[model samples]
Target: MQAFSKVLRLVELLLIVFSVWSCTQERDADVGQADKRTVVSLHLGIKTQMSSGCSSCELVNKYQWNFLYRIFSGKEDIEFVVYCSDENKREVEQNLLYDVLILVDKSPETDELVVCHGRKTMFQKAGVLDMFSMRQITELLMDSALENEQPLRK
Candidate 1:
């Protein structure tokens, strides 16, 4: 029954190949579905040396900025929009305060973080200069995104 034995081995090989192919296809489909999910927007405004005249402004250093940038840049569901006082003069001046209005809507300061879902403001925080504040902001953003995620259907 050499022919029968050969047939059984061939069938086993084919089954293994098909199982791998099926798993790969399922994983690809999951990734495609993830890409279709909504992306939340995070707007950040920071004052630079050029606009550092405000003595009361928060002291947001380069390292703090880089930390936020790294955490959000790698996330697929969050879109980070950074606005430097020196770099984006017009945009920051026009929309910084308008985009970030938490409890009391006032003028834009040195450091601000605004999380938005489409045009609506989901969360906002000001004077985010230290690592502790940054961590809080990160947790808030993640929570907001998770809250905004659509429930899956069975």
Candidate 2:
């Protein structure tokens, strides 16, 4: 009985590993496909600064990627339009929310946008909704885990 249980456990572990590997393969295969999308806009609560990897260009870049994710919701290639502006900082501060930590380690590469799946929304999408901070929206758009459709222009 003990040996049988151990074998069953091993089989379960193998199944789990296989499932994860298959999913990752599918995800990778799905990336870089075609899609219709655009970055609506990112109403940043505070402009990204030098401390983060975010360059002047990144502020808008983040928003662009987010727009694509919102519309496409997959790892497909797409040119997305972005809308960017400032909301009432006074209001954002009143709520006491700021800066999204995209990189766990404070590295320069982390400054660029990181994209990830499994999240339903980003900050830029909410226009004056007061639902979340602009920093978070920027983070979502910039997350490296998230995929990008178009080659960033020079």
- Top candidate, metric lDDT: 1
lDDT tens digits by residue: candidate 1, 1-154: 9999688756645543443344234435556444333233223333456756554333344455455555554545555544443445454444332222222222243344445443344445555456676776667656645665633221
Q: Please state the error at residue 38 of candidate 2 in Å.
A: 19
Most accurate candidate by TM-score: 1
Report the Cα RMSD per candidate: 23.0, 16.7
Q: After superposing candidate 2, which stretches have Cα over 4 Å from the reference?
A: 33-154
The clash count of every prediction, one per candidate, is 0, 20
lDDT tens digits, residues 1-154, model 2? 9999688756645543443344234445444531212222223323446544623433433444444445443323222222122332333233322232111111121112222232212222222322245456435444522455333322
- Candidate 1 lDDT score at position 37: 31
- Which pairs in model 1 have colliding backbones? none
RMSD versus native structure for model 2: 16.7
The clash number for model 1 is: 0
Each prediction's Cα lDDT score?
Answer: 0.45, 0.34
